[model samples]
Target: MDTTLEELYTQYPDTVKKNRKKHIVIKSEADVACPQIEANTRTIPGIISQRGCAYAGCKGVVVAPIKDMITITHGPVGCGYYSWGTRRNKARADSTTPKDKIYSQLCFTTDMQEPDIVFGGDKKLARMIDEIVAAFHPRGINICSTCPIGLIGDDIGAVAKAATERHGIQVLAYACEGYKGVSQSAGHHIANNTIMQNVIGKGNERKPGKHVINVLGEYNIGGDGWEQERILKDCGYTVNCVMTGDASYEDIKNLHLADLNLVQCHRSINYIAEMMETKYGTPWLKVNFVGVEATNESLRQMAKCFSDPELEKQTEEVIARETARIEPALEQFRKICRGKKAFAFVGGSRSHHYQHLLKDLGMEVVVAGYEFAHRDDYEGRQVIPTIKSDADSKNIPELHLKADEKLYREGNEYLNLSKEQFEALKKEVPLNYYEGMYPDMKNGDIMIDDCNHYELEELIKKLRPDLIFTGVRDKYIAEKMGIPAKQMHSYDYAGPYAGYNGAINFANDVAHTLTTPAWKMIVPPWERIEEPDTGKQEGAN
Candidate 1:
């Protein structure tokens, strides 16, 4: 099919078509890097954008997930409350939860009222930090400023410095205003640079054992961290702290101790991985546990990195065992889900990650896109050098890093290879690499970026896909259209949809969604009493 913008949106008004055409690209080859789709730009005004702000990207997604750090949203109460716990980054705080972690469960905010916003919110923020210390005595407090703080220029950095002195604890202030950039992507870069500068390498502690790796970007959503840890630990890889998810301030401080970093979400946390390489020489491997094939290949690559005979054997053994365990059900689900068309539009990297899982189930993703990913995310890292820094991107600060004297790894110590072998293996492994989401998608498959409500609705009506893989916001819209939509972001509050067993959960759930009988009632009786019945010649009464 010669899929073109005009053909796809023939009925759309010319103004809307002109704006959106560049954002959408029909794939011409499967998984081949294509740079046609425009990405990482500002959304058109008047569109109902699904993109979260920089504040949500930084405070909500990255910084706030630390199990022992108190993240205070330094603006309105609503911003604090709404972003709180919405991610379902389910963390554990035992009955003996420490004082530092107590405030982790609670959402703290300055509640920057009119008076505070007018005069300055800095005083209120400082006061809030004082109150937090007096009550919780937390080890660390991350102040995430909202839009008001940026507009008013309240000097949160000074407040943080003063608070750090007063409380004798770690107080980090982030200028992650909600309106900072094109999308939440700006916040991700902000958070990554901030942590790399202030937090990581601060501790003297070391995580012992061979194959010690930190899993960056795997936020413990629905116990994803637990499941990943389970597999990795079982495989003899000592799982260190994630970038933020379920990690404590103490745990994160020791991040420099890890030999290797395994990155899951490319858009969100890849910045940290890159900076870590620059500063500490800790090589990162791009790994995806969301799909069976991806997990297998990722594990194989990881094993190759550490050329241990036993570890390699162990990785293969685990793969065979796990694949056997899930193959029976996966096969059955594949039979049911075969040839089902899907459209995935979700936050950042999952739009790419979940496509593998869908493919595992024999589903063809007709369309896929990201809410806050850059051009590189869709076109591959080869495009990074070419991507022009727009005004919005330029507004966010980039860090300059150098190797730390004590913590930096001198060579490829993480990879068990001889100097010659290591150099040769670079061609094979290419550590700290991500191929983006393009290569996996076939020609004629549409790739969109920063997708909106109108585009989604129009595409769904036009394509009539079997599955809509999206977040909570648009799930119901698909259901209303009598199509099954899977909540890929939170997995509908039930997932370990990451590795071996999680793949089974995804397959079963997806199969159930498609095969479920309840869908017959989608066009309820109240809405439509009878079908058109074009075949019966209308039984003229």
Candidate 2:
């Protein structure tokens, strides 16, 4: 049987023909080599990649979780503005906590500006920290540097160190430049490493419950982390501290107390997991609460870690109940989404995870590409048995470049293209007019799969896709054009869209976007406005 790529080539010849595999032709060859999928391609030229920079990953995902830690953007105002309350994690605002209530649910940021970025931001960051300390008296302050800071070479670490000594508060400086790598995946790693070095054991560390585990990777989007929190508690384990979701400064410092670290996001938190193992002698395990399969496996794994039969049995019961409740809904989604075609081009981790979930929904991924992925991420895809030629390399970007081939050819970067392979791809994965790079007529349909603002407008006019699955940015455009658009990134505001249960959530999100009432009301500018009366009003006439 032919491999998926081989089948695509055979099914559509010119649009899908094969290209000779790329071998690393050295610069001495003076030849323009075809574009091999480079992990560095995460920062697309002129195109805004959905991937966040290092500062964002650290500040948004890692540092922000510490409810008691004041985070300062230390750059342009747009950075803080864009990130403010953007995460799906839910917390009861301090206002909602009854007057007598003791807990505070607040997320804060030191919004920075142009002057801050242009001049060194150290003074501003220091002042911001001081302001936060004076107002909230936060237990700690985390200063996250943005792109400009890195470019200007502002020493955020030095500032943080000096401030920590003066204020007698924990101050962490994370230098996550946007240009550092392709996606937030890299940012996650950087953040994890910093935490291991700075935040892990800076304060009073009291040993907690023996069964306690440090939850990692889960971002608590849509309160997903809280839901998991409840489930774990029900299972009788003390969730010592969640990595950052609904997490606090005190909680994070005490993370060392937990006997084990339970990580949900393998790509992002695995580094920390490994570090915990080495430093504290605490073992770590990967757990996903996204789907029934992963969720069950995760619970069982946790139980095994404890070697407790009763806890395992209780976990089984919880799974059975949740599975039964969602079974009917999931079956319905399977029926609807079966055989639907999808092309995934999100950042790597989600791209990889989405493959399994989509396959479960009976949908086929016509094309899949990761904006930033390394050699390891491609192992399952690269080794597919049925692949016949190098053209099949598109299935796995790294495979396109033979071992000897250098990735960057001499002249211009954008000029890099594989004529034969691109032609075949044009056919094999015929994008719906809306999805492909250009508007030129092609033999097959196209889905403008991975896109940003500019592509959204152009493609809407040229391709006129039936449905556009994208992030929040393009939702309005697709709607204005009278086409269905689904925000797949954050599960369209509903998710845990990971396993079998996620299938139902995915379908519902798609359907909701497709069938929503707002689409019908959109009208063209010319049609909606009546011409202004030039002839004039009653009295003047």
Candidate 3:
């Protein structure tokens, strides 16, 4: 018999257990009541959380992906050094740009010293920007302040402004310290706000296209954007820019010009979407290209929003042709994967996004959680109006965006829909809203928020899942417990897993992980006998 979640709650102390219970929920199959999980809170004092700090979220995940920008860490060298090349963010150099280089391939840091920390690191940070400009004449430079810089009260914004004036380049500073908020989520907000204030709608160039779109929240981890872009082009849509990932500084500035915005990762880039809509009259369509079926639905949603009969027809042809190509391989994997149970705990949207891909292979995600998702992420965006901001969230500032005087697009510009028609279309498609992950999940499935090590261990024991999709922090722990764990964040060094062909890649990876004979070889310490004082093995080959 599997261990019950109620029994796991007893492992914590009285007050702690009470707090943790709210963060967890086992959906009752026949119950009429909806289960709500408390989210976006600070983790317990002593437990080592799997969540990344604000610095990693801002620098590593968000701004660092811009290939044309020189992202300089405005703190100690270690902060920049350790984080470099950790996220498999990829990009290509476009010769059309001024520098025609991918600066994301390298790491640049202020390399603040002991004296600088005590006195101030701002001067050193300015020098570093000067050096970068002299060496590589890149398009722009983003100064990302780490934990130490924030503590020392270094004015990175001032330094960035001076550098911009002196070097004649776009230099923006991000105060995304690790100590900013409860988790990396705060950093995501900061990065989004910074981009909106300084970058978006600042472009001087425009491309001619009817079906133009800005693919936001796609950081191109493992070339995921390339595959997504290929399919979008096949459906006859001009990709204005893939936000951050494989995207140039010059490219992202024209984000306001897109007829539509296809938002992929809502958690990281939703701020830009909302602000852009307010300023430019562009409606964003929430999209998930992680799975084959979800990708088809997203494309269909895009076609619906545009209301172009010819584009809609072309989209249907692309979907039919691509779905036909991958169906055979999907079936082959389904044979080995059918009825298999999987567990997922990813950073933000991937946990929910990958569930669709797993289902396509005839596998079920029995348990899932997000490392740093808010209540709106678990429940629908309807809950956003009801949610009250805590102190941690209040630390970050909000952007008060208004309609752009010159470039602001009116409602009828691209949509070409009557008031009644647009209202009717929104019912079928998520025009400017996200329904969240709750509706898609099975009734009896588990949802966890900011899951800790102890909870993950208990889930592994109770669920006994065939596979675990998680981050690097918890991957080996699950693997040691004789379960196949795949690092979902970085794709475990494999990918382009975001579209038609990418679906097959995901299925193939799942098939390999499930059938790998190695996980069975792990003999957990708990499973071993009570052999006392000796360091020798009991059953030696």
Candidate 4:
């Protein structure tokens, strides 16, 4: 009987703010933790939670980046098929690259059949690696586990070890079972850890770009990495490597050569960044490349760290030129998008970070949710009263026998579940997902976290948000639905959407989505005419 706020209303309310009072309020002194959701929650015997396991994160985001690596989704074909290049990370294979080398850019999967899952996926994985080697001759392969793999106890690490020895190349295994954490965030950390262990420094290669820096956490989505690279080059610094986005195996092998690391997405890349700093004697800095404030500050801060007066001056110069380039268009977008309301549900740092950028365009984020976030990410944000997991809700539940029909009455404890059940839950859950359950949303606008296609489509159909800012997956759907969906993930093909120049890019991206002619191009299935029967007369003609 768990219900969404929209289900409670007779009709979907115009705004979350309008129907805020109808929802249940958390009682003070409640235990405030729901064992069902506590990463460790043992299936509650019956409550539903929308958290993905660790494997999904590793296979989906981290390991999927290996353009030259053959990845086997070692459980089910569905996971592999759905996750194949789901993001906007463009591959070099599709470009003017040679056909013989196409395997590097193509998404290869074991496409595990049911039989493999029933018995185990070890043999199939090894066979898939063999096939991949014959077809692409890649230097390495990765076997990523899925839900069933975890359940069946597949020792993918051992499998990878055997395969690597047999092939005389690198082979890594990731144990990212989706249920491993509360959200995909845990997967990111685990992914970073695996990279640190196996990929950081092993090969007989070193291109020490003395003036270069490693750009961490900035996935080359929509060429965002390329844009950042241009800016750095303009500032007279070579970008030696990008973390996973557009980063090559060789580039990563030589990553130690960089003088410093500039980390953008702190939540996902912090582990690797810190590891580099500790092991290599390379300093790392937390930087944001989102809005004018963060971008400018990040540049100035990095320049200060470099202790190079000329570099500091170059940073200022780059900012000035880029800022001037987009000022007029930004002003125009401000006029249309200003004062508009927004709500977000994104992975890791993006959910909170984008709020400031949206605000730059004069938009207000009435609601926000994160799929995988740490406590520090939410420390300063206000927590609103709403339905939350036992860990965060702090509410207690009591069974009230009201006229023979026993109903659970609200109590001070946050979790309604019994202790025995929570104790049986898993080892880790992404902390961010649990935190999302408690935000005082005020029901002002629609909010979602780790939303799937169906939920997003439904929300868009009902809410009709003014300018939908989300990743590329949701972008096309929004456009097809006649809703303005901006690619916040890649700045919608116009980037650097961070920094002083980025503010304009943000505005421009939003404006392009909002007023673009493409929104008008959505044609109904019934709109077009059928083909004429001209084929029958081909011989006679």
TM-score of each: 0.93, 0.67, 0.96, 0.69
* Number of the predicted model whose lDDT against the real structure is largest: 3
Give candidate 4's error at residue 450 in angstroms: 7.0
lDDT score, candidate 1, position 381: 83
Off by over 4 Å in 4: 1-51, 93-104, 203-210, 380-465, 471-506, 512-541
* Colliding residue pairs in candidate 1: 27-443, 27-444, 28-443, 31-439, 31-440, 32-439
lDDT of 3 by residue, 413-445 (tens): 658788778888878887888877777788789
lDDT, residue 314, model 1: 94
Model 2, global lDDT: 0.56
User: What's the lDDT of the predicted structure labeled candidate 3?
Assistant: 0.87
Runs with alpha carbons beyond 4 Å of true place in candidate 3? 1-3, 29-34, 98-100, 534-541
Best by TM-score: 3
Candidate 4 residue-wise lDDT, 465-486, digit = tens: 6766666565666667766766
Ranking by lDDT: 3, 1, 4, 2
TM-score of 3: 0.96
lDDT of each prediction vs. the true structure?
A: 0.84, 0.56, 0.87, 0.60
Model 1: residues >4 Å from true position, as ranges?
A: 1-4, 7-15, 30-33, 93-102, 524-541
Model 4 / residue 407 / CA error / Å: 63
lDDT of 4 at 154: 78
Question: Candidate 2: where is the Cα deviation over 4 Å?
Answer: 1-37, 41-44, 92-119, 203-210, 356-361, 380-469, 474-483, 495-507, 514-541
